[model samples]
Target: MRPRVLMVGSAPEERGGIGTVTTLLLRHGSRHADIRMVVTHREGPAAMRLRLWLSGTARVAAALVRGQVDVVHAHVSERGSVVRKGLLVLLAKAFRVPVVLHCHGAEFADWYRGLPGAVRRGIAWTFRRADLLVVLGSSWRNRYVELLGVLGDRVVAFGNPIELPASVAKPAGLKVVFLGRFGDRKGSAAVLRAVAGLPVELVMAGDGEVAATRALARELGVPAEIRDWLSFEERDELLASAHVFVLPSRDEGLPMALLEAMGHGLVPVVSPVGSIGDVVQDGENGLLVPPADAAAIRQALASLLADDGMRARLAKAARSTVEPFAIESYLDELAARWRSLTG
Candidate 1:
């Protein structure tokens, strides 16, 4: 019989990369192993979300008591996610099941630094006790080790994976695409300011602060095409029509949008945070800008717009860079790793 793995994270219906990764794992992993998901988080108001978590926690505890699970793979983010997963990790320990703590938050290091010393120590203790600690990149791996004193051997840096898009012809206009939350942390305001009055068509896709973003665009007199909450097909259509893709996030754990854009052969102009620098070589596959710098973003955008040859070369290289992150290869490796851990 295949080893039964208990995967803990957000609900399948939840948005963002964490949910995307979770859904992909459960889908592909079922072919190779017995994988069950216990959602400890969901999308709703505070009280509703809390109730779901409490109910989910009870279900997980019941599963442990049944003695059917061989491994507990917990996907964790920062702040409240960390606290919730910390409890799940302890619960898995009590049941004597091997645990994998997968850290996906890009702002975790900064968040950890801001916590009280006691809370920091507690977090470190929780991390150290896990059988395996999975990070999204080498940068994050180094931070976790330094912050938690985790053994180097215990941590693994695995990049996120995606299905590549079919080769599409480049569109006519110099279109720029931004697909993510329109929030301060995502640096949407800076993108608005930078792309303002530029001779490029900027397509801002996704939810959060939509009204604010529209207001900013009006204030700047920048006629950006803002699409709130696009479907997968809609997002792909926008990417296909783009010569450049820009996401100037303050933090990220290897953004799926950037990877998807690169896969669609859109040249990237993103902030160098999280695992982005590891994937995007400056002046090679993509251009990197400092976070929250509207002027710098403008300069980069202007440069890309001015140079057609540079954009074409970078676009070719950008697509090649993400080949290793293909979903099939990732799932094969993930399954093998799980087997080794469970055995």
Candidate 2:
């Protein structure tokens, strides 16, 4: 029999990494497990957000009482996400359900370290109690073990999966794409500065500080095409038509945009922060730049823009790098994890 798993996280309709991951799991994971979604967070006023959390928690409690849930898989980020999902972990433990805490925060370590000692201990207690903690890479796994005192055996690394495109037509001209939030953490301003006089045309899309991003682009005279968050089809179309993808983030947790862009055979010029170094080998499959360094970003972008042979070689290699991260392989591995917990 399939294990009954409650996949908890933000509303799948939201546009972000966790929402995208959760949506993928629900759409594809049903064949391997009886997966049910429990949205613990969403974008809205404070009252609406609180109501969603309360109702989601009530559903979980009810399911536990009725013996309907076999496992609780909670996707968590920093700050409020940690506190919210930590409570779910404790509740699941009280009901004797195996819990899998998936950490997706790009700056989780930084945020955790800045907390008061008592608050840190409370968070640590929540992590240590979980049956397993899922992280994006080996580095994150090591960090959890060393910093949070989570048992090494309890942590597992799983890269975010993507649907590898069968073929992507070579796009013409020097067009570059950037898909992520527009904020300091994502280095949106730095991206504008880097591309300011470059020969490449830039397309920037995503939520958060959109007005500020537009203002910065104008101030820099970048002439970049800045847009709001895109739908899946729009994103894919943009990826297919772009020659290069750049994300100079200060931190990341294996961004889905990076993987998807690479899968579409767009050469990546990204920062070597978070789990990006694990996926992108500098000068091999992609180019790595220092976070928040516009000069370095410009240098990397200039190198790729000037050399077609190098760009073609790197784009082909970039697609190859993400082939193993196809959704089928990820789903198979996740199914195995669920079985082990329920067995």
Candidate 3:
């Protein structure tokens, strides 16, 4: 019999990596396991967020009481997410259900360190209670075990999944696309600064500090086309037409946007932070630059724009690199993990 897995996280409509992951798992994971999602958070005012958390808590408690759950898999980030998902983990443990805590916060270590010592201990205790902890890559697994005192064996490295595109033809023009939140953390302003006076069309899309990004672009005299959050079809359309994908983030946890861009055969110019270094080999599949460094970003982008053959070679290699991260394979592995715990 298939084990019933209760997957809890942000709402699918929410914009960000966690929302994207939740939507994909719900859409494609049913074949491998009987999974249902409970949204404990969304993007909105504080009062609305509190109501959703309360309601989600009630639903999880009721499911536990009725013996409807075999496992509770909670997706968590830093700050408030740690507190919200920790409650669900404790509740699941009280009901004797195995719990899987999937950590996706890019700035989790820095955030945890800034907390008061007593609060940090409480958070560590909550994390140690989980039967399993899932992270984006091996480095993250090591950090969790060393920093949070989670058992090394209990943490698993699972990369984010993407649907590999079919035979994407190389784009001919010098068009650059950046898909991520537009803020200092994502280095949106730096992208504009780097591409200023360059002979390329720049398209930047995503939420957060959009107005500030636009202002910076105008100040730098960069003719950038800034858009709001995009739907799946819209995002793919942009990727299909773009020759290069750039994300110069200061921090990340194996960004879904980077993988999807590479899967679509776009040569990437990204920063070597978090698990990105594990996936992108500098000068091989893609080019890696230091975060927030406009000079390096410009140099990389200029080189890609100047040489057609190099771009094509890198684009082909980039697509091949991300093939193993397909959603189908990810679901199969996830199902096996759930089965192991239930058995």
lDDT of 2 at 183: 89
* Angstrom error at residue 203, model 2: 0.4
Prediction 2 global C-alpha lDDT: 0.91
Descending-TM-score candidate ranking: 3, 2, 1
Return the TM-score for each candidate structure: 0.95, 0.97, 0.98
lDDT by residue for model 1 (60-119), tens:
899999998888889998999999999988998998888899888888888999999999
**What lDDT does each candidate get?**
0.87, 0.91, 0.91
Cα displacement (Å) at residue 180, model 3:
0.9
Residue 250's lDDT in candidate 2? 90
What are the per-residue Cα lDDT tens digits for candidate 3 across 182-285?
99898988899899988999999999999988888888889999999999999989998888889999999999999999999988999988889889999999
Q: For all the candidates, what are their Cα RMSDs to the real structure?
A: 1.6, 1.1, 1.0
Runs of candidate 3 exceeding 4 Å displacement: none
- Candidate 3 at 112: error in angstroms? 0.2
